[model samples]
Target: MVDTLQLILPGFLLPYLDRFMQFGQELFGGAWQDILTVVWTVIKVMLIIAPLLLGVAYTTFAERKVIGWMQVRIGPNRVGPWGLIQPLADGLKLLLKEVTIPSGADKFVFLIAPVFAFTPAVLAWAVIPFSDFLVLANVNASLLFIMAVTSISVYGIILAGWSSNSKYAFLGSMRSAAQMISYEVAMGLSLVVVLMISNSLNVVDIVQAQGQGRFADMGLNFLSWNWLPLLPMFVVYLVSIFAECGRAPFDLPEGESEIVGYHVEYAGMSFAVFQLAEYSAMILGTALISLLFLGGWSSPFGFLPDSAFWLFFKMFALLVVFFWARATFPRYRYDQVMRLGWKVFIPVCLVWLLIVGCWMMSPWNIWK
Candidate 1:
């Protein structure tokens, strides 16, 4: 029986054993190098996440200021210099607020859902290529990996809704799930044109492809961006992401007027987690846009090496657009939102994908 078991296991286990042994040897062979790599990774993650957390805090301040300006009112001038400390004040308030769990909620899941939502929001930024060599992880499948991670974040919303045992939260979660799923398809298809032209899944590779001069080595201009060739796809992606992020005109999930939305019952820091996740996701989306279509970190005029400045500049530009849309547009009607996603954005993206595919294969090679 022992011999038979060994013979049977050999077929199934040998490959895994070999892989494990190889991994073990690699780890042991360069222990110091591995330690340095891990330390560097930790530092990089902290650097990225720290600024993001600060950005989230300041984004709230920015939003209030922008919305206040839009409404012709002075915004947040009370706390600290020019109200710069308002986010801190708000953070303190939320921290001091009472955290109340509902009488019959699932305590464990309810407590953990916010963490789940926030984790993916932060993790998705890891693959974003800030510059040629500044990316945290230069995965071959970065585009798909980002999509997968962003898609997984919806589960956090769903879980939060279900665990809350509140009708409004459940409805909000349902709306969010449906909206995210619908927009994700359009967003993915829109990006397909980018990948088709770049012919690479690596974000850095995509940016470099755009950096190549289009005409007689006249150094690539901004017009050579995917945004120009794939204008329709670009529009679709922008709108689709607005929906995916549950931002204004697409914030059906969190309709404060009619429904309190997903975090309806959440309080204190638990509620803060949802807000943090939302802003983080917004930053992630903007970063992806910068990397995918805006020549990521590359100077549009080609006078400068691709640097952090360009990455942050492009990302901040997109972030401004996000806020401008929120301040300018009204929440979309739920049915209209769904129809736009299904009937308009998805179909347009699909047709554009076909156009891009055909363009890639054409003898003329316009994109090339």
Candidate 2:
């Protein structure tokens, strides 16, 4: 169906497609005459994301199931197909529920916050580089673009917490803002090592760079992934991402146990928006890790074809790690979380950046 549409569609549906196909065919051996080929390509991407979105939806269900299994109890089995429809039912319920605006809240900003939060979460996927030649927007500074867009998402949480005019929500917002800013710094620094090694901010470049040289030549196999070379930075970045996403152990922003947290006053669809943003951000975090550390969409062994399979595999591994961290670790205290960010993770990332710098300059040339 997608192929048929692309073949018959007007030349100017998306001008960029024509240019990209021309560039690909001329430079990369892709077909040139049917530049609209990207239409079908885009359809494939959407097909991938459709399942991913559904997976993200049911991830909540799986989290409950797993947590339930850990606690020796049944989870959501009441909905259709052993609660397979629970996420859908949950969506319907949120849609049907009433959206109430607090009397004392700033109605406009309160409503706008979720939109701000949700937009960037989805938009970041535009440059994720799911596979070789398979991304929505293949920008030069894709990493920088992602970081900038994600940073903007913090404003949404801040607005949501502040506009609601609730003390707890305000506190949650403050925590969220501080957490995101601090972690973002560490996350950016960690990527410096990746950029330094790859010599490019384009994700595809980073992955391709890792493929050069043999094990004896580089002293390791494909396991010589950036994760091994920059292990400390990888750990710091992972921890920072948890804080950035406001996930468990670092979920102080929305610490339901202690405070109602941000979005405390949001109800129904408004609340659902916040949930969607959080899940989307989680998927984005995993995708970034896959791109940077796990060699984004590249096979682990180097012999397998570079395809979406590697992308999904790496992403799934990260997602499992996320759940494991959530299940195994206890939440950090507010002050402890702040201290860890400032005193620990940030400093480590900075030090590693310096180490990478020194390594780059030395005659050793570990990266080379």
Using TM-score as the measure, the top candidate is: 1
TM-score, candidate number 2: 0.86
lDDT of 2 by residue, 1-368 (tens): 33455687787774665665567678756454455466556775686578767877987887777777767788889999888999999999999999999989999999999999988877788788877787777999988999999999999999999999998899888888888898888888888878998899898888777766555244443576788879999898888888888889887755677766788899999999888888888988998888888777767664557788888888887887887778788889988988988889888888888988998899977667
Worst 10 residues of 1 by lDDT: 1-10
Clashes of 2: 0
Candidate 2, residue 158: how far the Cα is off, in Å: 0.8
Clashing residue pairs for model 2: none
Tens digits of per-residue lDDT, candidate 1, 1-368, equal 22333476758786785575567667787584576468667977998889889998998898888878888988999999999999999999999998778878999999999898888888888888777887889999998999888888888899899999988788889988888998898898888788888989988899888777563156556767667788898788888878888888787766788756788889999999888888888888888877777778778775656688988999888988888898899788888989999999888888888887887788967656
What stretches of model 2 exceed 4 Å from their correct place?
1-49, 216-221
Against the true structure, candidate 1 reaches a TM-score of 0.88
Residue 88: error of model 1 in Å? 1.1
Question: Total backbone clashes of model 1?
Answer: 0
